[model samples]
Target: MSASVPTVGSWHRLDRAGLQAVIDVLWLVGHRVVGPQVADGAIVIRDLRGVAELPTGWLDDQDGGSYRLRHDPVAGTFDHVVGPHSLKNFLFPARETIASFVQLNGSWSQTPPPAQVPPLAVLGVRGCDLAALAIQDRVFLGSGYVDEPYKSRREKLFLVAVNCRRAAATCFCHSMGSGPAAGPGFDLALTEIEGGFACEVGSERGAAVLAEAVAAGASIGGCSPEEVEAARGVPQALAARMHARQQGDGEPRPRSLDTHGIRDLLMTNLEHPRWDEVAARCLSCTNCTLVCPTCFCSSVQEVADLSGDHVDRERQWASCFSLDHARMHGHSVRSSTAARYRQWLTHKFAGWIDQFDTSGCTGCGRCITWCPVGIDVTEEIAAIRASGSGAAPPDGAAPAGAPEAGETAS
Candidate 1:
């Protein structure tokens, strides 16, 4: 049978059991279905065979430098917010051999790696992550230089987005205009309701895959009036709940970021004292960049076999926090941790606009939760914005207490 396409804006209903059929359809189509599950006390996305693998009945408590998972038997599978994983890690793997060289008769022959990226079906995506994907698309696809590897893998992938019904203490995607509700760039988007899921088809493939699931005996049909209203209220309800928590006096609520004049705000505050203060707490561990959904910092290296006849060029994920990331002529320009932190922060919020016309951050808050010392980007940016000196420090103005020349900083 030919693929069936549902109306783009139409709403549908799917009982909780139908969720497993959705996974079965993807598996039947030879897709390696992946979804979130409880792993090591955190929600992590990994290859999954069925709905039983999902992190159902799990709730996450997220805050600066902390992530803890608790259980509530009645909760939805995707109640957790952004984890350490994102679509970026799947599309752009941590390591890949882009090119290889072999020597024949003392001459080298360069060959590109064969493209064999598997078709992937990723479920339980969030709106902030979808927003991050667009930013990455701008960097790797829309930028003047196209990344072939990224393009090839992206073309063969399927994405299922889930609207966020709850926000983590560290979450600020709503302030970034990215989440609390799943947005575009998904094949299928699901809003979990009391009885089941309210489904929205964002792409023809989404509809076709869902239709396949139905044909395979999955339950799917028109939503009742109440279900439709509940579906529509997902985002608004989450927003109001987050607002109430933030307004209440107690533990920190979902974070909020003021992006007004943000680019100019970061650019003009190059010499803010906050950088030094934060640097005191920063371990320069690269946790923030690694966990960030949109940060694409990486480095390429050449490896050679013992025979010296075979060589391969490999690309590895890198971080600006590394002392060697800014190395030039045997010295790192951003030698101090404070300098490196400044570079990362400015580039994430300011220089990114210049490069990709979008902020490198999606307000996912993985950086905050994963940071060992809990260096919250939102808090840091807020401090700078509040206390920025308003003067553009001269070029190469080292951060406060920066190591002197020829001194190495950890």
Candidate 2:
């Protein structure tokens, strides 16, 4: 239970009983248990009650931004690929109230979400999701302003990050250098082994939780050194597999983009033709931002129950793609779809680095995979880069290496 990096510490066979025991320990300590479970025909994170709820043998088949659920008929166990949803939902909910207002006599009273956060144990969180968590932390709990609700809850959660043994076709975390193994931002890291599991305590809180489990008859037998080695190998092997799947023909060399000048690119390319091309294919449903792990833009709205006696204010997820998102002073800054798409991609890959000292994308590929038309971000960027110049000049302006409109490298 000590916070020592054990070459050989406690090893518990991670079977149904062992998993259930850990869950029980987490719950006993007032930690809410959340993990992957079969829902809506796909693996999704939900409130987990027991080991029976975990999707054991379910794997997923994904391609070009499409996903499907299928039985792992051969393994007889479902260790499915990561689903559309990430662990962000529980931490930064889709719909949350920052403050609420109510009418009391002739005055309006305001209330806010509780400052204190409940203990949470997020089980089966993938490496990509973990990376996403780190990015969100920068946005919500970073330097400029700390989001009260997010900051409070983030401090209380216990993360049990899982290595992705099976790579999803839609995943691009490796490109963004976020995953395939548990690095930082986790209290406990888990790797599922053949018979048992290899548990690595990542923090003092993790050690305490493991100690409680060990005390509760969670035996540390049958987890030999070889099992630990094997479990460790799985993550590395998975990483290689993920690397192989990344588009762009092998990994791009570690060359730093001049992110300092990226905002200029965004500002200059306002009238670039690529925006129109993307708009033609985009449904503008706002799915990309909704599933995006780092898109933190939100809007506040007031709701009144049918009784009309009370008004409750709520903060809901907002997307730049929404016309309402950019409305100001009876006019919208970006009413065109071309402008909307440009705003999103440029900020994510470029300006975000200035705003938060990190890239907005961890390359989880959720936005690409979840997009109805299969718009690949990598492909879009490649096209933009291949266009020669960042943007074309207006009217009779001379070409500054900008490609002709509708021209793309085949």
Candidate 3:
């Protein structure tokens, strides 16, 4: 095998054995490789020891509050859509101690997180999740205040994007304009075709990795023009199907979010009755916020040993749905469930744009599929739009016409 660094943007075809060589190459390069695999009856991102660990011949059928797996011998390894877990779980981990302080012998000590973290190579990254990474970049990196931990993990992340061949029922990336195809920010973007995968080298790192794979005996061959076009069509066809279905073009119920004036739509309709209606079904369980790719609400707490000698300050994922999310002086600002729900939705669609110049939601359908009660955000937004604006409820603290145009979060 000729070991050479594929130029950025080069196209090549990798057969099944060659694909495994790519994984082997990453492992040899000291990366902890992770990919999608069947676990607990769902396709979740997990550590991959080899290509066999991939969810081959397995397909996931996802819907509002429902996720099931099926086996298809002809299905590609990455045909399944996203599960509840995402890169957010790895990059911005569910919980971590940003800074820890210890006291003993009338002295105080401060310890920072370890700077050395193992590099990780993530495979089967859907375009929607890739878009989400950008959104988070704006928050943790682009934002004036940098979140060091998030940046550390993100910097070490090597993304392997997959051109989606199918979308789950709840998918609305077409409406959000986030996916159905891999965008920028990947090392290698793969399109699974008849005999193997067509790979596009996206970065210098990716090129170098391909070089290593070739040196390790991977079969990297140039793809013909027709084969490249066939590879490209995989994502294009999916996008077209979603677009047509979202337009109600002779299809059954379709999930979509209309973003035209979406900010003004939600900001002006705060007092709409849909809030109360959805809240009745809302479990306040934090499932939506947990699954959402860009929801960055967090909380910090201090831990002290019983001996009163050691203490640690930790931060964990938090949600606006929590009763104490906006608590100040032991009083919750959003005391009612309706108020909490309003805060999350408005922040995701409206306030986020104001803060980050982009909508927080990537329309990955994670929130909809993971919700126990199947309360779809797209449906709620449509209902609110249909109802126009409602008169402020009797117990409402804010006025109706201009009820909290922007949101304040912890």
Candidate 4:
């Protein structure tokens, strides 16, 4: 596949087959293409061999603590919004072996694991997740101490972002200023319409991939002006439909959070009683952090062979909800569920700003949709604000006898 120089800012139209052609070109260039697919009764990001693997014509119904996959053959393949998984799962694996050890003659030696980084091309990356990726990049790359594994994988990643046509019931990216439209950091972006994809290139790699697709006859040509106009209008139309859905009775909904002030709001309300109220409902199952695309807390575990001759040290995802997470000098600082939940919320919305110069949340709403108890962060913040309790309490001021927060009820 070949083509002349592509116009940098132009939008091109690639039909369904043209989209598949791009995937094929990616495979030819040694990229392990991954995208959204129907699996385990939900749309999930996974390794895809071809375009047929996409969850085409499937729509997802997501709300607090609930999700249902419905078939809508009439709808485009990219119609649904995000799912349980995020780009982090692939970039920063949940559990990974960092080192291995061998024991001989009562002496042990450690060696770093072999690098297994592979080229990856991710399709259908949502805007919020892209923002989260940038946050993760800051944590693992921008920070003075770099995560080598993350850097290796990140260097090889090729991102193809997609703008959302419709907002999920739990979505609040608009409030967070993270997305609805693809933002910076992607290689290529796509907006799906009735006949084909309206594509934009964000990098040289994206241009190369798109040129290959065009050369292979995957795209007819540059998008027509009318098609470009239509593509630009899809998001607005979807936003209106979402508004109607959210305001079924034509009643006004609560105003969105003033995210600009969220840092101060959370920092000042450290001892708000609303924390207790939310703690009552929060399972502390760590679903929020797990589903979160930017939560990077982890713990190291050591494993030994049955013969005790070999050992491996692995890094696994950890959650603040766990009692051991706050253990210090034989005492848990956040002994109460309220305190643990407070730590998570504060760290995400407040402390992160001080630490990373950015908010931890991208407002994808995965936490609300996947929580077993349906604990909504936006609602919790609203409740705290409504209480009008912004004064910070003295140290160690959490209420007594509060239940411990974990995956299960105490």
Candidate 5:
């Protein structure tokens, strides 16, 4: 069916089959489509061959240190929130070889591998992850030193973002001012309704693909007024539902930490007792940082063959929870879990703003959902804030053995 041409930001309805056609068009154009699929009992992001790869009829239940996938035939393909993976894995892989060296004639010869960058179309990306992407861009691109590998992958990326229709128990993106709704930085944004998707194009590349889909008769032109209204209402309805859920049993609705004063709140509470309380439960397993989309810590290692004829230098994902992460000479700076945890929280919430002009956390809540000990960052911040004027240090004197304020041992 031929439909009216869609203007930028206007909604266009595409049925399930039409969505498949859209994917086909992208693949034909040499874009590797990456999307969510069920793997090992959880929704995982991977290279997709077709629409059949999506986790259709599956929804996730997430809470602190917990996640379970359930079959709900009525749920849309994009119904689930987030999984253990994020866009970071694609743009910034867990392990990468920076360079390789070989001993030739008793002399070392170094060779930098050619860059392997692929054009990518990421389907079903959520808004909070988009926000996380933006923060990462600042870190990798906007910073003084540019990560060439990250830049190469990002330059060819095409984003198909999905606005959230339902909030997970661990989600607080709305509180972080990131989403429940799709925002900027996407090529196409989708809101799934009954039997179709309400799509909006955000870039020239998005517009081109959408036009191709329409020309091929994969999409019906012009969304109805009611459909448009419903598409716009998706995030609003999610927000209301989240509010109601938080206010269970007439209790006060859980509010996000006041980010405006968070820097001061954490800076002033360096010696707070809550750190000890949380450290007791923290395993220092680094699950929280690994699952976090914005945590970009990494370490480099050199591997050599048995004959020592060749060596490869690799960059691997690292976490603040690791003792080696804070090691200096013969001593570890953050000897206790308390110091490491404190460093992570303060860096994400406070130091990040100073360095990047934005918070490192997008509030996707994966850190909470995947944490083995169920350590909630929101609750931790709340506890420290509730304890006002905690053991104030003397003027011009730092806490006895505490690292300097805003100093990250990791």
Candidate 6:
């Protein structure tokens, strides 16, 4: 058992026993282990009893408007891509109560919830999702907001990031300049090699796990230099194949729209023709921002028992696509679909950088794939740019596009 930090030298190969041994040790340390397992016709995160419970041979297929589960057949011998759910659920959960207030005998008092049990190990997180977590760290932790729940969950997390051996059609982390390999931010990274798993320790917790598992001989053994290169080459090869098939050429760089002018553009385009086009297809489902790791918007709800003896205030996820999200004094600022859509798009690609000094979009493409109506964000941006340049909407087309949305444009 060897321990090293984020660099490549810290890598070791772990056989099945070694992997299981590490899981056992982490569990002993009071860490709740979570990973993808096959359930309900899809791969979802759940508690793992051992390596066997983790999804083996399970893979997912995603596109602009589709998702499906497929069997890899290779089973344990694969590095699966990140599933629809990322580590955010564990950290910034879908909803949580901060505290509750109660009135008793004409006196008001507050009851605070107990601290959360830190989820110890999150196994099989992909590199892109790892990057997304990093981005969220900047949003929730680094920001002055200091989301208390997110901070608590992050402090206890033991990340096990995996490189992408394959990418779904909708995946574009490579284009967004985020993935193909585990960069920084994970406690450990695993790459599926020929016979076992190539593991790299990225933190002290990861090193301790490696140390506990070493007596079991899960570490990689004598391999020709070529074999090591071959094992490491898998992710890069997979990335290249994905790039070849994607619609656009090279990386889909974030569109460098005029930042100085964007606020005015968004402010002015409230009633633009594109709004009507997009509204037709946008079910007003908040899937895009919901799946977006950087989207930190949330709403609070309070629950109380009939006795009024106990009450709880819960903060849950919110979406810009929802009418109530922008509501003020019984009216929403972005009341219409066109206004809401434009607000989200401009904020993501344009104003986010101006406000945060970093691009909000990592281009994970979750929005493109999860949308039930198949609204392509990239295509919409292209359409907006076209409309701005005096290219009229396609022969009575809606703001988003034609009534029929295509797979993805080149």
Best by lDDT: 3
Candidate that beats the other on TM-score, 1 or 2, i.e. the better one: 1
Query: Residue pairs in steric clash, candidate 2?
Result: 13-196, 14-196, 14-197, 56-78, 57-77, 57-78, 58-78, 59-80
Candidate 2 stretches with Cα past 4 Å from truth are 1-13, 74-78, 112-117, 222-226, 245-271, 305-309, 390-410
Candidate 3 local accuracy as lDDT? Answer: 0.84
| Model 2 Cα lDDT, one tens digit per residue, 1-410 | 32322222343345657667878999999988888888998888878889888887788766555778877655423357567677677778888877766676778777655556567788887776777788788888876888888877898988877777776666666656676676677777778776646776677787677767767877644455777677779879877766555424532211112222334455566666788998999888899998887788989888887766667667788999999889999878999887889889988875676676566777566787689898877667655654736532222332344321111100
lDDT of 4 by residue, 1-410 (tens): 12334556667777878788989889988999999999999999998878789888999888788889999879787889999999999999999887899999999898767767679999999888988898899899998998988888999899998988977777767666677777788888899977778887788888988888778776446766787788877766765565455446422232233354566668888988888988999988988889899999999999888998988888999999998898899998899999999999989887887777778888788988899998888778777766645522322233332211110000
Residue 93, candidate 1: C-alpha displacement in angstroms: 0.9
Give the higher-TM-score candidate: 1 or 6.
Answer: 1
What is the TM-score (0 to 1) of candidate 6?
A: 0.83
Give the TM-score comparing model 4 with the true structure, all chains together.
0.89
lDDT of 5 by residue, 1-410 (tens): 22557556666888887788878878888899989999998999998878888898899988887889999978888889999999998888899877789998999989777668669989999888988898899899999999988888899999999988977778877667777887789998889988788887788888888878777778546677888788989988987776566557422223343444566668778788898999999999999888888899999999898999989888899998889998999788999999999999988887787787777888788988899988899889877766756423323344344332222211
Provide the TM-score for each candidate, comma-separated: 0.92, 0.84, 0.92, 0.89, 0.90, 0.83
lDDT, model 1:
0.81
Candidate 6 lDDT, 207-241, residue by residue in tens? 77676666444453433456557767878897677
Error of 1 at 176 (Å): 0.4
Candidate 3 displacement at residue 301 in angstroms = 2.0
Per-model C-alpha lDDT, please?
A: 0.81, 0.70, 0.84, 0.79, 0.81, 0.68
Candidate 6 residue pairs that clash: 13-220, 57-75, 274-399, 277-398, 277-399, 277-400, 278-400
Worst 10 residues of 1 by lDDT: 401-410
> Candidate 6, 138: how far from true, in Å?
1.9
Model 5 stretches astray by more than 4 angstroms: 1-3, 249-255, 305-307, 390-410
Worst 10 residues of 2 by lDDT: 401-410
The positional error of residue 332 in candidate 3, measured at the CA in angstroms, is 1.1
Q: In model 3, what lDDT does residue 37 have?
A: 89
